[model samples]
Target: MSAIRFDDVWKEYGDHIVLERVTMEVEPRAFIALVGPSGCGKTTLLRMLLGEEQPSRGQILVDGKPLLAEPDADRGVVFQRYSVFPHLTVLQNVMLGREFRDAKFSARLFGAARRAAAADEAMKLLAEVGLAGQESKYPSALSGGMQQRLALAQAIMRGPKILLLDEPFGALDPGIRADIHVLMKRLWNETHLTVVMVTHDLSEAFGLATRVIALERSRNRPEERERYGATVSRDLEIFPRRRAELRSSVQPAPAGTTRSGKEHQPGRPGALVLKEQP
Candidate 1:
């Protein structure tokens, strides 16, 4: 289990102010959905948590320790664009998940025994994500929903302590979204990982998350918008908080050594994680 805290966080880009005084605490294995307007720094907050960007005036802590400057094995992410390599086959894409955490700086092919082990793991995840028959295909050949599934498979392959999703399912159609939502629920229920998601879909947020957080500027006049950055306007906790039940639903997969025996330092955005997107 892992917990996240944002203490007096602020972010700025030159003359533009995005978020201000954003403070919140996330309990272990909680599913949080962040919703806000387009330029309100919803994704910016996520990037900061992912270590892609830093808080201008405050800090983010994961399981008590401060977040690193770069993403580590403890955090994994899934982007809306399906953060998978278009060039690699579906199987190779999943293999990168294991290799990325192992290599960190660079993830490439492994030796025979290691490659076989990784392949087995990747295939299991692929089957779980319903991509068993598509292993030999490329990302370009799969539909949008299938690609996103592949992205999730890679992210889960790493066994992240915190899973950060940035509009991960916004691109899929209604039918596909519904199906993926079920898949998402299954993943969360089975893994019991702390997940934070950014989305514009309230129904989606309400449907899956244990908590829903809204951020927007109180004063949005043309002149006052920049002066007043967005803050958490509302935070709604889903009824019947089942976190304790979730912990017992499935055994937490050990990613790495736990800190203080209670906090798990499990594992990065499930980013074929080390290449430029085409």
Candidate 2:
């Protein structure tokens, strides 16, 4: 069954349309990586899923229910920037989600015993994400990779069914990015959470995603700008492979073609091309 579904969704900004007639279904526990050139509405689509932006037309459904508002714990997002609280310790940052969920008046009123329990759980999560020994450090003190891990811990602590990532590894160095890729794969395996990631790197998308989606502008001319917007030009499922093997085995998706060396077919479940909005 589809964990998430988009039906003829359109997003516009006054005269400029961002997304048009995007339609797709994300199966439960699917790892999706959305890849496209800059300004292809990749991030816009992720933002809509996060409820940070609303579509101008059509519906976004989660578990068969329409999404009508801002993000809740059901969907957690991690951006390219390390989104940890600067002043708060790593433990506190990870505990914030639980505290907010359990708090009555305010999270600050959460008692010592409750806070301790939350901390214990947070510690386990920190350990899982390779941040166990550094929980006392502030965000500034941690390395870039460590901070991202902390961010991941914070998001995972919420136990979100769907995780949305917008270039979560974009700022890291190659070695660090690779390390994070492994960490992320391990986490995904353990949690079985459905993930949608926006990335510019096609190799990254191919290596990590069970599915790859590419968006592109329907029309490029200045006169046609207002008449067209980005749509899902290509959507294809990727078979699973070890990260080590993925890079060597998979060739980059050629322009106007998918990683599997096939042109997109809208009728196919594995490679779909969405129609433009009216």
Candidate 3:
């Protein structure tokens, strides 16, 4: 069964059209990235998937059902900005979602003991994300990269089947961005969760996606032209089974830490290398 499907989807903002007649299907357990220039409706499409906006035309389905207004256990999302609460420790932040949304009534009803169990689960998730020992740290105390990892951990704590990432690493430095890339690869491999990411970075899309879908403006034929001129066309190109060799050289090292336990130089030997591969 398709994990997500979009049929002739279109979005408009009053007189302006954002997306036009977009159709696509995301297979179960697949990693797909949507790439396009700014204002090409990438974020708009993501918002549609998240049910933040209803399509002016067409339909979208998640696991063959209509999308929900609020995210559920079946879907998890990570955004560019860190969503961790500054006042809450990492473990508490990660546990909050599941504690409130998933646990049985008995657990939800009980105050202290249930929270303790939730904390345990949160710790396990933190360990999975390589943040085991930092559970007590506040979001403010962690580095930007670490905070992103914590956000990812929190999103996955509910064991969602589909993961949506909207430029989750966009703000990081090149070195830290690479590290997160490696970490994300590891997490995806281990969990096999279907992932759909919206990225402005072509290298990121090429490196991580099993398939890359590029959105472009569509052009109308003479027969279809209207008096106001042919509507702005939007098109998509899909590349499947992207080459792994293109990605092997881009594996990122940990942020702020070097093999010699010293600060890393910007032009260090192992800094990110972008190589073209088919």
Scored by lDDT, the top model is 1
Better of 1 and 3 by lDDT: 1
Please say which candidate is ahead in TM-score: 1 or 2: 1
What does candidate 2's lDDT look like per residue over 129-162, in tens digits? 9887888888999988998999999998988888
> In candidate 3, which residue ranges exceed 4 Å CA deviation?
102-113, 219-278
Which residue pairs clash within candidate 1? 73-267, 74-267, 75-267, 75-268, 76-268, 76-269, 77-269, 77-270
TM-scores, all candidates, are 0.86, 0.85, 0.75
CA displacement after TM-score superposition, residue 201 of candidate 2 (Å): 0.9
Error of 3 at 123 (Å): 1.4
1 versus 2: better lDDT goes to: 1
For residues 174-278, could you state the per-residue lDDT of candidate 1 as single tens digits?
999999999888888778578999999999998998888999988899999777889998887766543433446466544432212233222311100111213
Report how far off residue 106 is in candidate 3 (Å).
11
Error of 2 at 181 (Å): 0.4
Q: Cα RMSDs of all predictions?
A: 8.5, 8.2, 12.0
2 against 3, candidate with superior TM-score: 2
TM-score of 2: 0.85
**C-alpha lDDT of all candidate models, in order:** 0.82, 0.81, 0.70
Q: Rank the candidates by lDDT, best first.
A: 1, 2, 3
Task: Give the per-residue lDDT digits (tens) of candidate 3, residues 1-278.
Answer: 12577877888777666787777656555577888767677878888887778888889987568888665667778898857778888987898787667556632425787677888778877987889899888998888899999999998887787888989999899999998899898777666477889898989987887767777555444443221111223222234433222234234323322122222234322121122223
